[model samples]
Target: MVCESNSTQAAARQLGINPKLLDRGQQAQVVAEVGSEELALDPEIRALYAANKWLAQEFDVLKTALVFFGQLTR
Candidate 1:
Protein backbone atom coordinates (compact mmCIF):
# COMPACT_ATOMS: atom_id res chain seq x y z
CA MET A 1 0.00 0.00 0.00
CA VAL A 2 1.21 3.46 -0.82
CA CYS A 3 1.71 5.91 1.99
CA GLU A 4 -0.80 8.72 1.64
CA SER A 5 0.53 11.19 4.17
CA ASN A 6 -0.73 13.95 1.93
CA SER A 7 -4.07 12.42 1.06
CA THR A 8 -5.76 15.70 0.32
CA GLN A 9 -3.09 16.72 -2.14
CA ALA A 10 -3.14 13.29 -3.76
CA ALA A 11 -6.94 13.36 -4.02
CA ALA A 12 -6.92 16.86 -5.41
CA ARG A 13 -4.39 15.87 -8.05
CA GLN A 14 -6.32 12.78 -9.00
CA LEU A 15 -9.60 14.69 -9.21
CA GLY A 16 -7.92 17.47 -11.17
CA ILE A 17 -9.20 20.03 -8.71
CA ASN A 18 -7.37 22.56 -6.59
CA PRO A 19 -6.79 21.40 -3.02
CA LYS A 20 -7.85 24.85 -1.80
CA LEU A 21 -11.26 24.36 -3.41
CA LEU A 22 -11.95 21.47 -1.08
CA ASP A 23 -11.26 23.47 2.07
CA ARG A 24 -14.94 24.46 2.21
CA GLY A 25 -16.03 20.81 2.28
CA GLN A 26 -17.52 20.91 -1.21
CA GLN A 27 -15.45 18.11 -2.66
CA ALA A 28 -18.25 15.57 -2.48
CA GLN A 29 -20.71 17.77 -4.31
CA VAL A 30 -18.14 18.67 -6.92
CA VAL A 31 -17.25 15.05 -7.51
CA ALA A 32 -20.84 13.89 -7.56
CA GLU A 33 -21.68 16.46 -10.23
CA VAL A 34 -18.60 16.08 -12.38
CA GLY A 35 -17.03 12.81 -11.44
CA SER A 36 -18.40 10.83 -14.32
CA GLU A 37 -17.32 13.40 -16.84
CA GLU A 38 -13.86 13.54 -15.35
CA LEU A 39 -13.55 9.80 -14.98
CA ALA A 40 -14.48 9.24 -18.59
CA LEU A 41 -11.83 11.68 -19.66
CA ASP A 42 -9.08 10.36 -17.39
CA PRO A 43 -8.47 6.69 -16.93
CA GLU A 44 -5.82 7.38 -14.30
CA ILE A 45 -8.30 9.05 -12.03
CA ARG A 46 -10.74 6.19 -12.43
CA ALA A 47 -8.06 3.68 -11.54
CA LEU A 48 -7.00 5.69 -8.51
CA TYR A 49 -10.60 5.97 -7.36
CA ALA A 50 -11.10 2.24 -7.68
CA ALA A 51 -7.93 1.49 -5.75
CA ASN A 52 -8.85 3.97 -3.07
CA LYS A 53 -12.28 2.43 -2.73
CA TRP A 54 -10.77 -1.01 -2.34
CA LEU A 55 -8.31 0.25 0.24
CA ALA A 56 -11.09 1.91 2.20
CA GLN A 57 -13.13 -1.28 2.23
CA GLU A 58 -10.13 -3.28 3.34
CA PHE A 59 -9.35 -0.74 6.03
CA ASP A 60 -12.91 -0.96 7.32
CA VAL A 61 -12.66 -4.71 7.53
CA LEU A 62 -9.39 -4.51 9.41
CA LYS A 63 -10.87 -1.98 11.83
CA THR A 64 -13.91 -4.14 12.45
CA ALA A 65 -11.78 -7.19 13.06
CA LEU A 66 -9.54 -5.32 15.44
CA VAL A 67 -12.56 -4.04 17.35
CA PHE A 68 -14.05 -7.51 17.56
CA PHE A 69 -10.79 -8.92 18.86
CA GLY A 70 -10.44 -6.09 21.37
CA GLN A 71 -7.02 -5.33 19.93
CA LEU A 72 -7.81 -1.64 19.63
CA THR A 73 -7.61 -0.06 23.05
CA ARG A 74 -9.63 3.05 23.71
Candidate 2:
Protein backbone atom coordinates (compact mmCIF):
# COMPACT_ATOMS: atom_id res chain seq x y z
CA MET A 1 0.00 0.00 0.00
CA VAL A 2 2.77 2.41 0.83
CA CYS A 3 4.58 1.67 -2.43
CA GLU A 4 1.46 2.20 -4.51
CA SER A 5 0.29 5.27 -2.65
CA ASN A 6 1.63 8.80 -3.07
CA SER A 7 2.00 9.24 0.68
CA THR A 8 2.74 6.70 3.43
CA GLN A 9 0.40 8.46 5.86
CA ALA A 10 -2.36 8.25 3.28
CA ALA A 11 -1.66 4.57 2.83
CA ALA A 12 -1.97 3.94 6.57
CA ARG A 13 -5.11 6.04 6.70
CA GLN A 14 -6.62 3.98 3.89
CA LEU A 15 -5.83 0.82 5.84
CA GLY A 16 -7.60 2.30 8.83
CA ILE A 17 -4.43 2.41 10.93
CA ASN A 18 -2.11 5.06 12.31
CA PRO A 19 1.02 5.98 10.32
CA LYS A 20 3.17 5.02 13.30
CA LEU A 21 2.00 1.43 12.75
CA LEU A 22 4.39 1.37 9.77
CA ASP A 23 7.43 2.09 11.91
CA ARG A 24 10.79 0.48 11.06
CA GLY A 25 10.93 -1.80 14.15
CA GLN A 26 7.50 -3.29 13.38
CA GLN A 27 8.50 -3.78 9.70
CA ALA A 28 11.76 -5.45 10.68
CA GLN A 29 9.96 -7.86 13.04
CA VAL A 30 7.41 -8.69 10.34
CA VAL A 31 10.21 -9.36 7.80
CA ALA A 32 12.11 -11.60 10.23
CA GLU A 33 9.00 -13.66 11.03
CA VAL A 34 8.08 -13.97 7.35
CA GLY A 35 11.63 -14.93 6.35
CA SER A 36 11.80 -17.60 9.08
CA GLU A 37 8.48 -19.09 7.94
CA GLU A 38 9.50 -18.97 4.30
CA LEU A 39 12.79 -20.78 4.94
CA ALA A 40 10.91 -23.65 6.64
CA LEU A 41 10.04 -25.12 3.25
CA ASP A 42 9.59 -28.56 1.66
CA PRO A 43 11.77 -30.33 -0.91
CA GLU A 44 10.36 -28.68 -4.04
CA ILE A 45 11.02 -25.18 -2.78
CA ARG A 46 14.42 -26.27 -1.55
CA ALA A 47 15.33 -27.38 -5.07
CA LEU A 48 14.17 -24.03 -6.45
CA TYR A 49 16.19 -22.23 -3.79
CA ALA A 50 19.31 -24.17 -4.76
CA ALA A 51 18.75 -23.37 -8.41
CA ASN A 52 18.33 -19.69 -7.58
CA LYS A 53 21.60 -19.72 -5.67
CA TRP A 54 23.33 -21.31 -8.64
CA LEU A 55 21.91 -18.71 -10.99
CA ALA A 56 23.06 -15.92 -8.68
CA GLN A 57 26.55 -17.41 -8.67
CA GLU A 58 26.54 -17.65 -12.45
CA PHE A 59 25.45 -14.00 -12.68
CA ASP A 60 28.32 -12.94 -10.46
CA VAL A 61 30.74 -14.85 -12.68
CA LEU A 62 29.30 -13.14 -15.77
CA LYS A 63 29.72 -9.73 -14.09
CA THR A 64 33.35 -10.51 -13.30
CA ALA A 65 33.95 -11.62 -16.88
CA LEU A 66 32.46 -8.36 -18.14
CA VAL A 67 34.74 -6.32 -15.89
CA PHE A 68 37.79 -8.35 -16.95
CA PHE A 69 37.01 -7.85 -20.65
CA GLY A 70 36.27 -4.15 -20.12
CA GLN A 71 39.66 -3.67 -18.43
CA LEU A 72 41.45 -5.63 -21.20
CA THR A 73 39.83 -3.40 -23.87
CA ARG A 74 40.95 -0.25 -22.03
The residue pairs in collision within model 1 are none
* CA displacement after TM-score superposition, residue 68 of candidate 2 (Å): 0.3
Give the clash total for candidate 1.
0
Instruction: Give the C-alpha miss distance for residue 49 in model 2, angstroms.
Output: 0.5
Return the top candidate by TM-score.
1
Which stretches of candidate 1 lie above 4 Å from their native place?
1-36
Could you tell me how far off, in angstroms, the CA of residue 24 lies in candidate 1 after the best superposition?
Answer: 29
What candidate 2 gets wrong by more than 4 Å, as runs, is 1-41, 71-74
| Model 2 lDDT per residue over 35-60, tens place | 65355334465566668879999998
Instruction: Provide the TM-score for each candidate, comma-separated.
Output: 0.48, 0.43
Please, what are the lDDT tens digits per residue for candidate 1 over residues 1-74? 12233887788798898777654344354356445555534657756776887999999999999989999965
Q: How many clashes (backbone N, Cα, C below 3 Å) per candidate?
A: 0, 0
